[model samples]
Target chain A: MGITKTQIFNEEQNDLAQFFKVLGHPARVAILQYVSNQNACICNDLVEEIGLAQATISQHLKELKSIGLLNGEIEGKKMCYCINVERWETIQNQLNNFFNKTKSNCC
Target chain B: MGITKTQIFNEEQNDLAQFFKVLGHPARVAILQYVSNQNACICNDLVEEIGLAQATISQHLKELKSIGLLNGEIEGKKMCYCINVERWETIQNQLNNFFNKTKSNCC
Candidate 1:
């Protein structure tokens, strides 16, 4: 893959693309949906809930957390995870802004 | 990379992920923005406008078109490109639905 010329784009474009890139994988999307659907923080349930291996789930969770979309904590032997609500809202608004501002004008 | 377990995910999850994956690249996002900002179809200008090589720009355009976000046609010598308005609206709604339905309940 060619190196991305991220420097050529503004902050909003780069930031928005990063968010979308992290969410590009189905495992990450499924993980986000599962965690967000829960009433409280979840621990060690993702492997069973998403039907992926523990390491695989951890990798997906790591990707989501890298973007600050998921908040996680270590509780003894288990690591608990939940949505980072503020970050979620911020990303939602960012996406909305991109879509709203870039309304197409041509055929 | 492990093969994505697409079968484990529902249609919505797979569809949304594909959209996000295509938009994940900054070059693609820039291409879409440039095309949408234009009042008419753009042709041969993307290489200059996006500061990418002709081949690189074409690849990115292909990815955008693969997701149905871009409409393109050959205008004699130059290939004209524009946003697919219907597909854009549908994707916007899909993103909004995913965000709305998966409202975070914790942390």
Candidate 2:
């Protein structure tokens, strides 16, 4: 968790928690959904869509990118951002594995 | 996004965010795992298993319970906790719906 006690748990648990941590904010969820629904990646559109300032939107985008949940490129004068499909699926699998592993018949 | 903007996002996104927020901690993840793998339930075992103090483990357990991912019962002197199957299935479906909604082809 901190510096010395990180090794007790395996990598998968840590990675899954990180993904969830990045997704803990509503703004990030809105950003991801807006990007996912668009035919093309929307950069500036998010500022308007989420009703947040440009800087706040950029901060959320950066957090999403930190988890590899998104990718962006400079398109003409602006940057276009979209979901990282491979990473999304990777996270999907990770979450699926975690949820599916629970037998849950005990209580 | 703040006091005036809570209505901007729908209910599902908010609920999803809450779940992610609770699961953001590795200690909580470990606690859930330890509870899930047992046949009955483990309350005090977690203190030893996680190697954390009693108060620390209780705090994590409270967070997990608040999210409805766990259920506990007062069994004599100690309490026994286990995964809430119906709620687990509910959250599993929620995560699945969120993930499966993404078309994710055009990155």
Candidate 3:
């Protein structure tokens, strides 16, 4: 397929789409859930918690980080990861705005 | 990229991922916004409004329909589409629950 004609859409539309796209994978969703449930940000626990290969989990983690939904820090030999709350709140607001503002139904 | 290990994840994770995946495109976002803003459901107007190719818009509509986010009804010569409120509310709640429930800051 040709590249998405992003210019045709507004900034909010593009931003909302990006927020949704980052959460589009089951592995990523499970990873965020796992990290959020823990009292401390996690490192090596993800591969076991999510039941995915280390490489796969790492790739998912990378995608999550690339989108600013997740943050990672090197802790000696391991990298600890956690949800980036600031970005999460921004995404939540965008999502709520989209869902809550659509009024007067059709069809 | 290998296939996603969907079997490893729970039903809720899969469902949430599906909701986001369907909305991951700017064109679809614009289409939903356009249809919601209109007083009546729409069809061909999307191609012009979204400024995308007919096939691209049709594909986006199909994906939205697949996830129950949109509904289309054939009217005489045109197929009108609109946001599906029931599914929209469900997704909205799911997103809210995910965002609201995550607490306890982590670095």
Find the candidate with the highest DockQ and give its number.
1
Clashing pairs in 2: none
Over B4-98, each residue of candidate 1 has an lDDT whose tens digit, in order, gives 88999998889999999999988887887887787768566888887888988888888999998888898888888888888888999999999
True contacts recovered per prediction? 0.74, 0.53, 0.73
Sort by TM-score, best first. 1, 3, 2
How displaced is residue A64 in candidate 3, in Å? 1.2
**What C-alpha lDDT does candidate 3 achieve relative to the native structure?**
0.82
Q: C-alpha displacement of A25 in model 2, angstroms?
A: 1.1
Query: A4-95, model 3: which lDDT tens digit per residue?
Result: 77787789888888888888999888888888888876566888878878988888888989889888988888888888899888878888
User: What C-alpha lDDT values do all the predictions have?
Assistant: 0.84, 0.80, 0.82
| Candidate 2 lDDT, A1-107, residue by residue in tens | 44425566678778778888888877788778778888866457788778877988888889988988888888888988878888888888888888878545475
- Tell me the tens digit of each residue's lDDT in model 3 across B1-107: 55777898889899989889888888888877788888867457778777777887788899989998888899888998878898899889997897887633677
Docking class of 3: medium
How far does residue A32 in candidate 2 sit from its true spot (Å)? 0.8
Top TM-score: which candidate number?
Answer: 1
TM-score, chain B only, every model? Answer: 0.92, 0.86, 0.91
Clashes of 1: 0
- lDDT by residue for model 2 over B1-107, one digit each (tens)? 44424477788788888898888877788888878788866467888888878988898899989998888898888898988888888888887888878635465
TM-score of 3: 0.93
User: Which of candidates 1 and 2 is the stronger one according to DockQ?
Assistant: 1
